[model samples]
Target: MSLNSNLARKVEVEIPLQSPSNVPEQSTGMVHRSISKKSLATRVEKMLMGIIMAIAFTLIAVSISLEINIASTNRALQDTKVSILNTTTINSNLQQEVQELSRYDRIYRFANKQGLKMNEANVRNVVK
Candidate 1:
């Protein structure tokens, strides 16, 4: 047996590939699954957006109501302050009038005008 025999040389093996016409339809299931996943994701995103909008609207309503309440309370406080000041001013005026009316000299002049005579011996002092 000679080592230089051409017919006894080693041969390379080749694997055969399938052509487009011979290939099986395995991508149909994958396409259906991808479409379903996209639709499900879209629905979830829409639901989340609606929930966020609802929360924002609720917060806005609450803030508006709080502002109205604060405004009303401030108006009431201002009215109360004005009323207290007016009452104090009226009370001081009444006190001054009372003091003027209770003077002894003024009372004596009124008595003389009424033809009343003063008798010092019968004068009475009353204390309250």
Candidate 2:
């Protein structure tokens, strides 16, 4: 049994051993692949999408600007209407004053207070 064991040890020791550093290396060259290009229809579609986005943005901006302008115009119109109403009231008061001042009795009393003598022959009645 001892002799058989010694023969087994000798056989194990005689076998060859391989290390990682002693192994052969494979090729490290770059591989080539075919380059693909987009089709004309796909390019055109992308361009049209960009144009549509730009047009949409422009329309939104224009509508907002017009809305602001409309609001401003409405404010101005409201102010004008208020001014016209105030002027109309002032004009009505002035017309009432004119009518009072132009009354025949009022004028006659004023003339009497000023020591004016009435001349029936020279007096003339004016018609509007």
Candidate 3:
């Protein structure tokens, strides 16, 4: 019925603040940081992928180096084989020449054709 009473009835009420001791205390050393499971999983997956890629790159480099070494060794072996074959051919030809010169008649004819005189004392017999 009075204006003051009507105004008080229409006003909204508010609660008073309680003492800080009524609320639970937060620990000093505790951290409240949070990461989503999806973000954590993505981070772990990215780390694993990076590790796998590094290992793969290292293996590929080693394999390429090994391949190069093998190719070089193979080339060296081929060159050695070629040198051996050439030496064998030269040895065979030298042996044939020595055999041809070992005949007494061939030696005498060759000395005569070259206008060289053979002395008896200059001839030596090789006993094998």
Candidate 4:
């Protein structure tokens, strides 16, 4: 009955309990909690996943580029083949015409037309 009213009305402060985990968590928003600790294994796993995806994407792009180059090369080769065939046909035709124009009868006829006479004594057999 002798105690002061101020002592009885003094406010007491209570501390909140700490979390069990070694790292602390932060409340970011009303619905989300942010982690303060990032494990090494988790970071490494994410890095490895990103590297693998980048490599895969690069390989796919390279493969697609190679396919396009191959198609272009194939088309160029086909065009060259056609040109070669055409040129070869023209060469063969020219050779055939030369053969036709070089016959003994044709030569003799042209020679006679130019007022040239063949002398049997001066004729020599040629060997190839």
| Model 3: lDDT of residue 15 | 88
Between candidates 2 and 4, the one scoring higher on TM-score is: 4
What value of lDDT does candidate 1 attain over all alpha carbons?
0.94
Alpha-carbon error at 109 in model 4, in Å? Answer: 1.2
C-alpha root-mean-square deviation, each candidate = 10.8, 11.9, 11.4, 12.3
Q: What local distance difference test score does each model get?
A: 0.94, 0.85, 0.88, 0.87
TM agreement with the true structure for every prediction: 0.66, 0.64, 0.58, 0.65
TM-score of 2: 0.64
Best by lDDT: 1
For model 1, residues 1-128, the per-residue Cα lDDT tens digits are 68777676677999898799887778888999999999999989999999999999999999999999999999999999999999999999999999999999999999999999999999999899
Model 3: per-residue lDDT, tens digit, 17-92?
Answer: 9999999997644433334556778899999999999999999999999999999999999999999999999999
Tell me the number of clashing residue pairs for each predicted model: 0, 0, 0, 0
Model 4, range 22-119, lDDT digits (tens) per residue? 56765566233223234556788899999999999999999999999999999999999999999999999999999999999999999999999999
Q: List candidate 1 segments past 4 Å from native.
A: 1-30, 118-128
Model 2 per-residue lDDT tens digits across residues 18-106: 89779977444421111123455677888999999999999999999999999999999999999999999999999999999999899
**Ranking of predictions according to TM-score:** 1, 4, 2, 3
Ranking by lDDT: 1, 3, 4, 2
